[model samples]
Target: MGNTVIEKIIQAHTADEVAPGRIVWMDLDIRSARDFGGPNVVKNYEREYAGLPLADKSKTYFTFDLCAPACTLKYADNQQACRDFARRNGVEVYDVDSGVGTHVLMEGGLARANGTVVGTDSHMNILGAIGAFGQGMGDVDVTFAFRTGRTWFEVPESVRVVLKGTFKKPTSAKDLTLYLLKVLGTKKIALRSAEFTGPAVAGLSLAGRLTLCSMVTEMAGIIGFIPECGAEARKEIESYTKTPYSPFSPDGDAGYAETIEVDVQGLSPQVAAPPSPTNVKPAVELRGTKIDSGFIGSCTNGRFEDFAEAARLLIGRKVKKGIMLKIVPATRRVYKELLARGILQDLFEAGAIVVNPGCGGCAEGHVGLTGKGEVQISTGNRNFAGKQGKGQTYLASPAVVAASCILGHIAGPEDL
Candidate 1:
């Protein structure tokens, strides 16, 4: 049987024939940890190795991404511990104000396409958009990798997802992901690798692919795979994109446990209501639903395109009375680009507050937290109860979130 893209990657790393359901140990091209669990990883490493040096300090990265800028004293201390550890060990660290850890690694050229990356953040699978076999593990797993430079995985079965046609305007990768979650159901994708193919996926920009793949964790997927298209799609983006990654595709007649196809021409903007990402419906269905806050940022949808699209919608309009709109770029580079383009200025003038880059307010306990009994619309990946404070969160595309800010209700860009 022909190997799937993921299978090909694993085989190359191991230099041995491997198949689904088999356990294999492979060398990691990159290993990373973030602020939330990084301190614990450091402690574990110290406990295991004492004064010994890390297996490969240059290959490891630690970033202060979660609760960046230190929401409180405890968070600040945690970040400080990571910083001190990186300094002493000579490992690379992306400090607060740098950006999300995954974005930092990709932008810094550490996450190579067709390479194996293991990270402490589940959403690290977003790297698969570049054809890397990115997997998330626990802090202990990362610590083990730091010590040994190797990790194990049970090769997951593959799910072939073919996207055809074009995404209707105002609908984007976020909508595509939501529509997939709605049809596939989160439970069905658990522990499986999703390989995106067909013409629609080919048309997605690298940033859009990042947005689509970033949310695979929400569906419990091991990774969301997008086969490399070609040189044009593989060109390195300046400042925002730094990595030059080789592309790979599944062999014809590759084995897949299931195949699903989505035609974007008929797809509409979608929203996942409070308490579950799987509770999805057309964005039009949720129109007129009042919201107290709207957010446009996260690893999933915080790219430059997201901010520019949102700024376009909000420039001539003001955030509705009594509603707070928060815009956060995913990285310092993106933030700077937004400022250079006057997108940040336009957002501020429209009554939207542009916060520092990083996972702001998406995971809560940071800026833009909502209060009890309030309603919110966001471009974040999840809307689980209390995920962003005690209020309810409705997940939508960045365009939807931006339009909602203007209407003070859940809405799509078409509503504008």
Candidate 2:
């Protein structure tokens, strides 16, 4: 049988035949660690490698995203450790304000089609949006990758998901992804790679594809790839790369462990209820659920397009009295673009708190952490308790977050 997209990439990187379940050491194009576990990686590297030089310092990097700006002393020290290591080794550091590492890597062109990148961030697989192979591992593994310029991976069995029909107005890629979570469930995709194709995905925008792949981690997937990533994504990849970058595609006769289809004809805005990303349902069904705060940012939905959707509802409207709405762009580039478009001023006038570009509201101690007993609707993935704070986090699209911010409850765009 012909190979899947991951298999083909692996073969090229390793120069060896690959199959599902096989383990191979693939040369890495980029290696990184974010602030959260980055210190551990530095410690491991120093302890294990001692005075040995890295295989290639140019490919090494440190991204400060999670808890960026050093919310606490411990985090501050951790970030400093990573910076010190990068300074001594001549490794690049996408510092505190740079944004989410995954987005930063993509924006900088280090993560491109058919390339392999490994990092400490669990959401690194979000790079698959552009057809790259990105994986997240523990600090020890990352240290090894830093020193050797390679990492071993177990080829995952691949699944073919065929999406039929188009999204109606008001529904978005975030909604479609939540619908997938509701139908496919984590059990179905756990440890397996999924290749998305079909009419529904053909004309999807680059931001939409990024939204879809960013949530694969929530689906318990190894990676979720949207191959044939259109001209927009290709242009972005080509603009950053020194060499020609062709997105990887599966062979026509590629063997899939499972094949499934999703009809998105009537899909609507969706939400993952408090405490779990998998507990997804139509947002309409949960309308009126009271929310203390609303957050419109994260690697998943913190791009310019995501905020633009929210701006449509907030430009002339005010956040409900007593409700706190937080707006955070994914990267400094996204933040600057919004400023240039006047979206930033409009958001501020709407009574929203627009913070620096980074992973806001996505984890504990981040920009929008909820207080005890509070209920929040956010664009970030993962609602697991204690991750976003002691209070509950409900995941939804930027449109939903905007509407809910104005209405004081969980709501859909139509509610406005």
Tell me the TM-score of model 2. 0.97
Worst 10 residues of 2 by lDDT: 228-237
Question: How high is the lDDT of residue 19 in model 2?
Answer: 90
Error of 1 at 98 (Å): 0.5
lDDT of 1 by residue, 1-416 (tens): 89888888888888555899999988888988888889899889888888988889999889777888988888888889989999999998898889888888888877777889888788889998878788888999999999889888889999988877776678888888898888778777789999988766776777788988998888888898878454445774333345445557788989999988877676889999989998999999989999999988888988888988898899889999999998889999889989999889999999998889888776654565889998988888888888788999999988999999999998888788
User: Residue pairs in steric clash, candidate 1?
Assistant: none
TM-scores of all predicted structures: 0.96, 0.97
lDDT of 2 by residue, 53-137 (tens): 9999999999998887888999999999999999999999999989999999988878888889999988899888888899998
Q: What is the lDDT of residue 174 in candidate 2?
A: 92
Candidate achieving the largest TM-score? 2
Where is model 1 poorest over a 10-residue stretch in terms of lDDT? 236-245
The regions of model 1 sitting more than 4 angstroms off are 228-233, 237-244
